[model samples]
Target: MSTAQLVSLTLAMLAGAVTLLGLVIVTGRALHRRRTRRDARLAADFRPLLLELTGGDDDIDEPLRRLAALDRRRWRAVEPSAISLLTKVSGHAHAALVSLFAQRGLARAALRDLDRFGAVRRATAAHVLGLMGHTEAAPALAGLLSDRSPEVRAVAARALGQIGAAEAADPLLASLAAGGGVPFHLVAQSLIRLGPGARPALAKALYHPEAAVRAVAAEVLGLTGAVETARVLIGVLAGDPSGEVRVRTARSLGRLGTPVCLEALIHATGPAHPHAVRVEAATALGDLGSPRAVPALCDLLGDPQYHVAHNAARSLARLGSGPAMAVLAETVAERPGTTAAGHAWEALAVLDLQAGQLRRPPTAPVS
Candidate 1:
């Protein structure tokens, strides 16, 4: 063929391919819309029956049987909304939903999906199983924590948490120990969802061989505000070799707010402690709102770490005594244009606001 004819032919083929791609995209979008509408209609039809089932007054065996008769597509639409209500309701209502899931074999179906090669499929399966809150699915979900997919592992941890079975605690902790891609924060959240039942395991974790595990355990215990673990946490703060663990322990100790916790925090703020530990300790003392912390917090204002000085100033504002106020004023005057000065000025304002003195403090130029 001539050169001009060859060029023209190539251009025609490119145009055809672009047209085909556009057609496929449009067709896919149209199908998605149709599926969404169908799902919405099915959800509306099931809403009333699901609400009635949640009331738990009537015999639900018949309703559950009827629900189980739904085709897979319709059941998929209804299950998400059902689980949404299940999460909000407890007692008989929650039990009714679990019974419904069992009658429909949803948990079994989810378990089968856990073995699927697809990541999204495995994650969704883990979510559904978790929502069912059935103990039978816990082992399968626990196994997924070792899956190659990070997304799948995270979802499985969440599912284990939602199940709230104490048996899942050790498995979850093991996953943390194995050091897969699963984030410590997600694992910590899962443990928190297990409630007080997980406290003993978490306390044991405070002494885990991995410093990360011990640090996370301290953080989770503090969030739980379980006073029973305060002594253990104080010990960790005082002696744990890991500076990160000591920092987390200091924060948790502040959340605990016991007399012993206060004492431990005061010791942590000492110059001998690591800078990170001292910073968190000073911050926690402010959170405790104890007048006894005033002296220690004041001493922290001259800490070499700017963060420690800033936090100490803020805590003094929280304490709101004449001595604390005097320290803030001095820091603001002596360290003008520095971060410490800014913190001191802000602390004075916070004190004024709390005292119903809303007038703006005299401005100093910040460098």
Candidate 2:
């Protein structure tokens, strides 16, 4: 063929391909819309039954059996809603839903999906197992903490927490180390969810090599009310090399609120520690609510760091003791125009406002 004829033929083929692509796009969209409508209809039909199961305190066996017996396609349509409600319901409703999921073999399917090649599939499976509160799935979920996908790691962390697996605490803490692909907050919350059962692991984590892990462990120990671990936290506050870890340790020590932590918190508030550590230490003194922290907190009221001084004043207010109030009153009366005085005055005002609110009579209801 002549060169001009060849060029024309190529252009015609390109036009045909473009037309075919347009037709495919339209057909795909049409199919997608049809599928969506069908799913919505199925969800609507199933939602009331699901709601009846989850909302009532009455017999759930019928609803449970009906839901479990749904055909494959119908079950798939309602499964997402069921999973979404898992965390929202409680007591009999929750047990019924979990039973329904188990009866449908969802937990087993989800466990299998935990090893799926697709990250989204793995994450979704982790979520489903978590909402099901599947204890058996804990180990596999913990394994996903080091998954290549951050999202998968996060889902697994959350699932382990939902399952209340105390053993997963260590791996969750480990995930806080460099490149663990999980957020520190997620791990901490999960650890908190594990509750006091994970205290041993958390205390051990206080010694983890990674500072981030150590820091989160310290923070969680206090939040989880692990009073027995207060001494370990005190040591961390006094000697941990990581400033962030020391700061968290101080706060945790305060939350632990043992009188033994008082000296360590006081020591942390001294000039030897970083200002951040001192700030948290001062704040922790307030949380400790010990009269012994009064002197240390009062001294902090004059620290060069505004936050240190401000938190010191606030903590003294938190103490809510005669001596603690006297210190604030003295600071306000004698240290006028200083940073200490300003914070002290603010603290006093807050206290007075609280007092006034307490004394004020409740308004009578309208006739």
Q: What is the clash count for each candidate, in the order shown? A: 0, 0
Runs of candidate 1 exceeding 4 Å displacement = 1-36, 55-65, 71-77, 320-345, 354-356, 359-367
Model 2 CA RMSD to the hidden true structure, in angstroms = 6.2
lDDT of 2 at 282: 86
Over 1-367, each residue of candidate 2 has an lDDT whose tens digit, in order, gives: 9999999999999999999999999999999999889988998999999998888757877788899899999998998888888878888888889989889998899999988999999999999989888999998999999999989998999989989988888888888888687988899889999988898888888888899989898899888778888777878887889999998888888888789898888888888879899888889889999998888888888888999999999998988869999999888778777778788888877877888843232233355
Report model 1's TM-score to 2 decimal places.
0.81
Clash pairs for candidate 2? none
Q: Give the per-residue lDDT of model 1 (tens digit) for 1-367.
A: 9999999999999999999999999999999999999999999998888888888676876667777788998898998888788779988889899888887887888889999999999998898888778778888898999999999999999999989988777778777774666799888899899899988889998989988788888998999988999999999999999999999999888888888788889989888998888889999998777778877876777677888988998889877757777878887887776666677888888767887888465567655
TM per candidate comes to 0.81, 0.92
